[model samples]
Target: MSSNDLEICKRFAAERAVLDREFKGNVVVGIGSGSTVVYVTKCIAETITRMNKEAEKDGRKPDLNVTCIPSSFQAKELILRNNLNLGSLESFPLVDWTIDGADEIDSQNNIIKGGGGCHTQEKILASCSKELYIVGDYTKYSPKLGTNWKKGIPIEVIPVSYVAVKRKIECRLGGEVLLRMAVMKAGPVITDNSNFIVDWRFPEGIDNWKDIETTLKMIPGVVEVGLFIKMAIKIYIGNEKDVKIYDFSPSNE
Candidate 1:
């Protein structure tokens, strides 16, 4: 297949190999919102369809019922496109596995996501999954978090409380805050749940990001931030030839 970058295809292939090899039986799959995760979603649907067809050819049919819960609207569309079974978070609170794409990943496997503006829901789904795997190209990897992908942290804030939240981030926190505007859409960049997005940037040389994360969450208007602290179970860093996987655990800290 033709692609803009050969590495994209390789990353998709590697993720598929891992999922097909590991993920089996009645699995509640979590579909993440992003270009890279798109491939993983496609693989899940393809595997289900293939299994169904194989069962039809045999004397007995099989029930390859893989219920998928999506992270965002984009994810929902992908699931429908593949003719995969759809389930809601309330229906399927626990996911067998989740594969997502990251904007940046640290050595400790912490991630900075929501580049697509699905941070809040993504974080919830990622946290609920029994195993969360992040997929990205070599550019998303860093010795430490917040090195590359410098669009700041994507913060989900209440629509009515945007101004106060912005002030708290800019004036109180001494950071830069930008309300994400709408370009293609009519109104502001509305999330799947119709929430506004605010991108916040802080100064470099921070020892404890956990403190900053805590402070942001304490803000009344702030719903959630893109800083995925210790939520990733594994991350696949796509490079030339093969993909490198990093295991995240508190024991490493």
Candidate 2:
């Protein structure tokens, strides 16, 4: 296969190999929404089939029943397409693992997600997991999240609250905020749930990011911010040569 084809398949295969080793029998998995994580779902499907085939050859029933929880409508569709079992948040309270991608990851391991407009559900699914693993390419790693993911912080809000929420982010917070327009193919870029997205920007050299995140969340119209703080347990980075894993344990640096 060519490099372009290799890039698409190789990265997903590497991530799948890691996940297959981590997930054994009867695992509860969270499927995150994004282009990179789409490969993750595909990997899970192949792994499940391999396990089932192995059991058939041994004349034994496979106990590797995988239940997948989706972070978005796109994720839900992928789950069904892969022939994997599906469950809702209300049905499965806890997940064994969550595999996701990030917009950016810093030294602290805090991330910026929501590039697919599924920030709210992604956050919920990630928190429900026992261990959350982020799978992505080297381009996503950054000194800070907003530094590389210059798309700005994606904030999901109630439809009626868009105007008020925009003012709070731009005026009250003294930062730049803009209403995300529908550029993909339409009048407005409506989300799966028909909610609007507002991207917020802070000064280039922001000192207190945590404080800013806290302040923006306090706004009434805001539903959820894209700043994912202390959610990932480990990150599996896909470099050109190989895949490297990083733990989110406490560290001075």
Candidate 3:
């Protein structure tokens, strides 16, 4: 598919998250990285403005305001461009909600993210939030986590440990691990935290993600794995037609 179509789908998913009407009171929101979340930041800023105007008319003193904590440099820029108040996890460690874009997600609610190399902080922010919601296009919505997301699981690792991690993944876990290369610059793509990312592509799609998640996390020098097991409370998927919301309750999973 064309990049434009994917952008449209991403924006649709972002709109769905912003229009949820869940930010009723004072809220601290964790903003995740990716082209998709660019629209999410805009929607939140516009919504906050509208809410404040409504509060003024209702004589409620225009109390609606949000402090947004960004997961990466790109996400921080989005928040700034929208003129939203920026916050740091240092101050507001616990947030009301988090919105992130995933590379792929499955029916069982497992997610793989970090295609843009922000999974480390994204996972951190999600862990700090009361609710973590994933936003993505229909193409990323898979019946199983690894089928449609050809890029594989993005695993961030310490630079020195890349070789070891790559070997361990291939030998122990049964997947081909390749260091993610930079498109514009030469050499491997470096993350905001100065970590390297390796995409682990299994021969077949994953069946037991929870076990794999644990196994990957056990590897030394592995900062974080893109496999977001049971982290997403809800997922919003967008297509040319409309947006669909899938609830991921423990009982249902």
Best by TM-score: 3
TM-score of 1: 0.89
Candidate 3 per-residue lDDT, tens place, 1-253, comes to 7889888888899999889847666799999988789889989988888888888888888766689999999989998999999999999989999998988888878888989999999999999999898898888888887677788899999999999999999999786999999999999999999989999988684588889889998999899999888888889998887899998856766
Evaluate all candidate structures by whole-model CA lDDT and list the values in order: 0.79, 0.78, 0.89
TM-scores for all candidates? 0.89, 0.89, 0.94
- Over 132-174, each residue of candidate 2 has an lDDT whose tens digit, in order, gives 8887776778877676788888888878888899887778766
Q: What is the lDDT of residue 249 in candidate 1?
A: 43
lDDT of 2 at 66: 85
User: How much is the lDDT of residue 172 in candidate 2?
Assistant: 70
TM-score of model number 3: 0.94
Best by lDDT: 3
| Residue pairs with backbone atoms closer than 3 Å in model 1 (clashes) | none
**CA deviation > 4 Å runs, candidate 2:** 1-21, 184-186, 249-253
Residue-pair clashes per prediction, in order, are: 0, 1, 0
Worst ten-residue run, lDDT, model 1? 14-23
